[model samples]
Target: MEESKAGDLFAEGVVKHYEPELKKVEKQLNELTSKQSSLLKELQKENVKFSSIDITELTSLYQMMKEYHCRLIAMKKDILAAAERSEKLKNRAMKLKEYKQNIALENAHYREAQMKREQDLIGKPGQPL
Candidate 1:
């Protein structure tokens, strides 16, 4: 019973530890999404303004678009990595919970067997159970 309680506590701790990381990743993804939206709007505006053939201005806009694309890609990768880590932690917690349940089931079976033994002893005197 104590061991099961300990396992539960450990699993809870693990879950709590991952919660902050999950929230952080979600926040970062939200921020990135907002930035991406702004960049898309900027890109659309720049494309409209590109009617004048200024090579230097076109080059600057192209570079800005590329940087925005790169950052968005990197943010997506980070989000995926964080999601994978969170899933792993959840799986670990599930396994720990299963282990504790198995222990409790085993303990219940042992207690039942002890009770049966005691009952048998009451029926039969000076007999080894």
Candidate 2:
């Protein structure tokens, strides 16, 4: 119960903490993809063949693209790790809840038996034991 709530809250907080960072990474990847597409389109319009392009002129762009790709891969790994953590937390919370319910049910059965025994001793509110 309470433990589960606390665990869930903590998990949510962790997710929230990383959400913005994930979004920023995704935005950067999108921008890079768009830039790459536009660059390719411009080359096509100019009838520039890949072999005819100056490697030196495009070296920086290539480096930047590679860096962005690496960052994207790192971000993906982070997101996967976060998802695994969240799943583990959820399983823990569920187990805690199930254990709490089982304990409550056992307590209820015990209380019921106790009440029955007391009623039997009292002889059902009658005159005899």
Candidate 3:
């Protein structure tokens, strides 16, 4: 039916719209992860030489590492939120597809019944062939 087609299209559109947003968030997460890894490596190297480092420089490095860690956590949360939104859109699309199939099946059954009625009336009293 026209309504079924419209609903399917709408659901697909929503899914398509969210897909780009999901990809962007995932890319951001990947970049943040890479930065986090590099920061960790640097921190490890600094830790190994902690006793020989100047106190002020060490403090500055620690503060910068903490900020990077916080940002990494925020990126991870954004990715999770985006993923959840994308999943919901996908589920809606699937449901719309199922609805379209059901509509088609119902239409088929109705048409078959109408055809059978027409066949039965072909030679009936007062009904034209």
Q: Which candidate is the best by TM-score?
A: 2
Tens digits of lDDT, candidate 1, 1-129: 999999999999999999999999999999999999999999988988876678998899999999999999999999999999999999999999999999999999999999999987687777666
Off-target runs (Cα >4 Å) in candidate 2 are 1-56
lDDT of 2 by residue, 15-117 (tens): 9999999999999999999999999999897785776888887998899999999999999999999999999999999999999999999999999999999
**Residue 31 miss distance in model 3 (angstroms):** 51
Candidate 1, which segments miss by more than 4 Å at Cα? Answer: 1-53, 122-129
What local lDDT does model 1 show for residue 98?
Answer: 100
Error of model 3, residue 14, in angstroms: 97
Task: Find the 10 residues in a row with the least total lDDT in model 3.
Answer: 120-129
TM-scores for every candidate against the unseen true structure: 0.48, 0.56, 0.51
Candidate 3 local lDDT, 1-129, one digit each (tens): 999999999999999999999999999999999999999999999988976879999899999999999999999999999999999999999999999999999999999999989978675787655
Cα distance off (Å), candidate 3, residue 25: 67
Candidate 2: give the clashing pairs: none
